[model samples]
Target: MSLSDCRILELPRISDPRGNLTFIESDNHIPFGIDRVYYLYDVPGGAERGGHAHKQLHQLIIAASGSFSVMLDDGTERRTFFLNRSNYGLYICPMIWRELHDFSSGSVCMVLASRKYEEEDYYRDYAEFQEAAEKRG
Candidate 1:
């Protein structure tokens, strides 16, 4: 598709003095749907997570506690995003290689996914991911 097709995902925010809250709903906040929730935490500075690509999963990632960045690549194009606020999220589409890096200390990244954990869904090898993405075109 186009770059616009893989842009950031807009999420709903609720503010209160007690605290703020954000929600991600299946087929609602997300387009495809949702089935999984995972969080990454305690990553040191200059460290990274997620160096793979998914076959058919969509995700909405948020900085629930602190801040982090997501670097997305689609073989031909790339984008870097900073998620610092709890009320915001980054929606990542499938077939895109993503690297979640640059985590500030105490950062908690919550990911809402559209697919369950399937071993076949992951492309752990970069060379394999590139070949598969090219084949899809």
Candidate 2:
């Protein structure tokens, strides 16, 4: 749940004269099994996303196009990462407070989640997240 627990996964890049390709598969580059894939788009400046934390699900986030950044906080520790390439990803463990920001124009962020959509699995407030994380200790 700390910044130290988060990791950057360098995905394999297949270079071609025309273009480059990258991919992430379950039981491979991703630490957790992938069950869902979603992308964020059309984010204007001064807007933010992912102001929440999951209780159990893990996520592998990629900047599929353009660039973006994520601010990670685990109640005590904080770290920020700029994701600007398609061949890289950020692996976020459970109980980490994450906020996605600074999206470049036409940027698209893809997230591979370990679990399907479950409202109960989400902690939408920092105070609530802290309480749950504390209880887990």
Candidate 3:
């Protein structure tokens, strides 16, 4: 998929006097089925995560608490998305390189993925990802 396939998705939310609640359903809130779920937390200041691209995985990343920024690179162009709200998610398609950075203190980045862990599905090198993107382009 291209960078154009990446977008921000708003999730369903309910507000009450005490607190707010958010929920996501597979293939309803996101474009794919949920196969894995994970989160990043307690990230030290200036620490960065996700310097890779998935060959076939689709993902929805949400800032469950606090804030962070996601930088997407699609061989020829780049875009940065700032995420702070709990009810919004960033949907990422396959073959796009993503880097998560500028995380606020105690931030939690929750990810709902379309595929389970598969080391062969990852492009951990930017140069390799770029090369593959170019060939596919």
Which of the numbered candidates is closest to the native, going by highest lDDT? 3
User: Highest TM-score among the candidates is held by which one?
Assistant: 3
- Assess candidate 2 and give its lDDT: 0.90
Angstrom error of the Cα, residue 135, model 3: value is: 1.1
**Candidate 2's residue-wise lDDT over 5-95, tens digit each?**
8989999899999999887779887788988999999899778999999989899999999999999988778899999989999999999
Model 3's alpha-carbon lDDT is: 0.97
The estimated TM-scores of all candidates read 0.91, 0.96, 0.98
Candidate order by lDDT, decreasing, is 3, 2, 1
CA displacement after TM-score superposition, residue 2 of candidate 1 (Å): 5.6
lDDT of 3 by residue, 20-132 (tens): 99999999889999999999999999999999999999999999999999999999999999999999999999999999999999999999999999999999999999999
Q: Rate the local accuracy (lDDT) of all candidates.
A: 0.83, 0.90, 0.97
Q: Please report how far candidate 1 places residue 44 from its true position, in Å.
A: 2.3
> 65, model 2: CA deviation in Å?
0.6
